[model samples]
Target: MDRLLSIEPLSAAAFAPFGEVIAAGAALQRFAINGGTTERLHALARARADDGDVVISLALAQARQFPFEISMLERHPKGSQAFIPLDQRPYIIVVASAPTHQPHAFLATQGEGINFRAGTWHHPLIALQDSSQFLIVDRDGPGNNCDEIALQPSWWLTGIDAG
Candidate 1:
């Protein structure tokens, strides 16, 4: 009684076992270039949380003037994956979750590249184009590995250009 899918375009053999969607190689930590000098891009897996209080959120996502939103989520009850980005003039989007079947529709592709992999069942702050430059890693402390599923029969990101 909960099934809807429309998110695709993830390789490495269709995101082999749901893990590893690379590329973000340079320009991280709020992303800066031309005058601000701040870099260190490319990171998909780096979690820590045995419970000690952790909640972090850094920023620098401007494209359409800040309207992207993703209410902090981290999960890995022995299974975690994520790698997010939709626009930032880089390109990367790979969110994983499919060991049997739950994917009915999800799509990504439109400027700034995309990236997703860690516990990927994405539908948060997905910019289609002209607005993206993010660096978010989950699981920090206080029994981390967050979880949230607030879907109300409305999900769509169906293939772009059918490429």
Candidate 2:
């Protein structure tokens, strides 16, 4: 199993080669805020939930506040994408491979997030010191959108140590 690393905020350009580098804060087009007044607000790509044209809800839970465990890791083989909202203060982990370099590990801060490409290697439901509830938006279709990669039972990244 690979060791977990801290979530860092690198330029979106770094992830361009693999797929589109969309920042949550950039893709969103805010519609409403405060009172009746409205404006376009761009949110994190991985933070926005969209089911065609619907906006779903996501939440978060703190560490000690709620005791929980992640019993699995899943992947998407088809051209599926995911938007996992960090409702609480938690971190994110991304496992990707560079064309000519060794595989890389990425950890994102509570404010940071990721948009995984279909078939990318990733951990399932990672919560660092929090029962981070997420607005998980992925393909809920015919074939299996959730592909579990069974590794050593201990293959887990349990905390945020991004430095």
User: Evaluated with lDDT, which candidate comes out highest?
Assistant: 2
Leading candidate by TM-score: 2
lDDT by residue (tens digit), candidate 1, 1-163: 3243445554434654544444443223345565767554535344433434333444355332222223222335423433345332433242436323343223434322233334555444443445455555444544435455544443333334322
Q: Which residues of candidate 2, in runs, are more than 4 Å off?
A: 1-7, 17-36, 41-73, 86-88, 98-102, 150-163
Q: Give the TM-score comparing model 1 with the true structure, all chains together.
A: 0.25
lDDT of the structure predicted as candidate 1: 0.40
Overall lDDT per candidate, in order of appearance: 0.40, 0.47
Write one digit per residue (lDDT tens) for candidate 2, span 1-163: 4533334553456654333334444454657676858664454443222232223546563443222223335556654355454453445454544222233334444454556666665555455555566665454445555566543433333443422
Residue 99 in candidate 2, Cα distance off native in Å: 13
How big is the positional error of residue 70 in model 2, measured in Å on the Cα after superposition?
12
